[model samples]
Target: MLQACLNGGRMRDFHPALPFTATEIASDAALAVAAGARELHIHPRGPDGAETLEPEHIAETLQAVRSAVPGIPVGLSTHWRIPPGGLSRQEPIRRWTTLPDYVSINLIEEDAEDMIALVLGKGIGVEAGLWSVSDAQRFVGLKDAAKCLRVLIEINEQDIDEGLRAAAGIQAVLRQAGSTLPILMHGDEASVWPIYSEAMARGFDSRIGLEDGNLLPSGRMAGDNAELIRAALALAPR
Candidate 1:
């Protein structure tokens, strides 16, 4: 599956075209899906143009996107940086009155286990995010690790070689731990295109969008998420 991470922690300062409101996100969703994206992941923002975990914000965002693209599988981020009390995913998970089809939880977080348990209880699927080899072990050690919807192998290393190496290391740990869940892998800005191509080469689900990076494989800034998805599709093997 090809997912589009519409707007992450990225803001207007990073790119003027980054979507902030529900209507903007919904428009991006419609265009991206039309261009071949199979799934969506978004970071909801507040009235102040800052990332937010507020239920009203999430509901408005989800509702708009769902209305624009009825069957698209949407997911939200449990990023700790959003709230004033940084490093707390549990708080948002606790406060959420609205839920997405799934949510991404970084296993490197302090409250990873508890938050995962809570999300599962709410009948919301979990995207076990592995940011490093250590994170892979963290997921493997979970009580019902296999029950997660999918594993997200995210490489933050900007150096292409180092990032690809990081991806391999995480994958090795998961294999050693007998993890059989499907993987949705992608990389940081400098490594995204190469790693995305690698993911496709290995038959793994991959993603792209403003959240990942603004650049295309040719090193030019993408016009939008739809253009990014179209470029990604061309890289995939037929």
Candidate 2:
């Protein structure tokens, strides 16, 4: 399914167009869904535009977005920057029952396994994020690889060519793993469209949004999440 990453780890200082408040995220979620996104991925932010895992903020954000686009699967970011690690952040994962349909976990983080276990225990899907080929290989080595809810292969790069190579390397690792777990591939910045096209060609689902790029494939500043979604749909394989 096509998922829209409304906001990521970045602050508004980096991209003023980023949706920080619940109202803005909800509005963008509605627009993205209308434009063909079947799922949503959001990173809730506090008033100062920093990421947060506070139950109240998460609850309000999920409620607002889900209310606008009913039944659409909404995922939350379990990024280390928000809650860091250890017993303290455990409450956020436990409190997830109050909000979110799924939560994303970075394979490179120290507490990735614990977080994954927590999410699975709670009956919530885990969107395992692999930023590099090594991360993918590490994930493949895990005993519960197939048990994951979903895997998102995020190619991090500023240049399109390099991103394509990175994605290719990740696919090779997955092939070596000898498993057919559901995979979603996408890239950030200048690599977004190139890797997205590669995803379509490689027969994998992909994602697009302001978190991936503040501008459209044409390099023009996107007016909203829907605009980015429309641009991505146009590039999907026919």
Candidate 3:
């Protein structure tokens, strides 16, 4: 499956066309689906244009995007610092009035296991985000690890060789742990296309969008999320 990560915590400075408000995000959702994205992932932004977990902001964003792409699974990031306050990390999640189809939780974060159980109790699917081999090892020990919708192997290493090695190491850990959950791999900045290509070659699900990078595999700046999706699809093995 090819998921479209709409506008991760990116600001307008990162890409002028990056969506922020509910309306813009909804519009992008439509275009991205049309471009062949099977799933959607986003980071809802508040009025201040920062990633937020405020109930009102989450509701508004989810409503708009789901309306735009009915039946398509839409997920969002559940960063531990989204609300950034003295409140417990799970407080914002508890206060959420509207929830996404699933949420991506980084395994390296504090309270990761507790957060997974909380969201699972709420009937929300979990996308375990493993950024490194250690994170993957940590995930293998979680009580509800097998219940996750998928494992998102996110590579941040800048060098192509290092990034691929990082991905392989994580996969090795998961394999040894006997985890059969589906896997989705992606990368950030300079590692984006290379890791995405490798993910496709390995027949694993992958994603791309403004959140990952503005440039296509050809090194040209993408016009929008749709363009990025198209470029990614073109690389899939036929």
Candidate 4:
């Protein structure tokens, strides 16, 4: 299913039009859903414009989006304000609630197992986020693969050509795990369109939004998340 990454890992300094408040995010979520997004991925931000894992912030964001687009599955990122060694802390995970349909956990951080366990115990779906092939392999190696909930393999542009190669590696890992779990692939920044098109060609579910890139396929600034979704749909193989 196509998802809309409303916002994640973004700051006001990165893009002047990036959505920061619940109101703005709600508007974007509605537009994206109307544009064919079945799921919504969002990262709640605090008043200072920094990513926040606070329960209240997440609640407000979820509330707004749910009010705007009822019944659309929503997911939140657990990579909030994550520092080099901050994943071990229980504070962030403690704040997560079932309000969001899914919560993404980056494998790069420490104590990933514990965090995943907590999320599962809370009955929340998990989106295993892989930034590199190594991370994908590690995820595949994890025991009880069924607990992952859902998986989203993220290919960052900084990895360059390795991005597509990493996607292939992830497919291999999924094969070895013997899991037919739903997988979605997408890229960040200027590389989003290329990888998105490639994802569709490979017959993979995917997503797009300001979180991935603020520019449209035409290289112009996208006015909103709907614009990006429309661009992605246009690029999808007919």
The top-ranked prediction according to TM-score is: 3
Better of 1 and 3 by TM-score: 3
Q: Across residues 1-238, which tens digit of lDDT does each residue of candidate 2 receive?
A: 6889988876666567778899999988988999999999999887776788877888888889988999999998887767644546767668754667888888988778777888788887888899888889888887767888778999888877778888878888988878687889988888888888888887888899888888887888888788899998988877
Ranking by lDDT: 3, 1, 2, 4
83-200: candidate 4 lDDT, tens digit per residue: 2226544575576563688888887656666777877778888888877767777777777457776678888855567777877787787787787778888888866877888779
* Candidate 4 regions with alpha-carbon error over 4 angstroms: 80-85
Clashes of each: 0, 0, 0, 0
Q: Estimated TM-score per prediction?
A: 0.96, 0.93, 0.97, 0.91
Go through the candidates in order and give each one's C-alpha lDDT: 0.89, 0.84, 0.92, 0.79
The CA lDDT at 137 in model 3 is 93
lDDT of 3 by residue, 1-238 (tens): 9999999988888899999999999999999999999999999999989988888999999999989999999999987777663237477789887989999999988778888998999999999999999999999999899999999999988999999999999999999999999999999989999998899888999989999999988899999999999999998888
Q: Rate residue 121 of model 3 by lDDT.
A: 91
Q: What TM-score should be assigned to candidate 3?
A: 0.97
Q: Which parts of model 3 are misplaced by more than 4 Å? A: 85-87
lDDT of 1 by residue, 1-238 (tens): 9999999989787677899999999999999999999999999889887888888888999999999999999999886677754556466667777789999988988877877888898989999999998899889999968889999999889888999898999999988998899999998888898899889988999999999999888999888889999999988888
Which scores higher on lDDT, 2 or 4? 2
Worst 10 residues of 1 by lDDT: 84-93
Which of 3 and 4 is ahead in lDDT?
Answer: 3
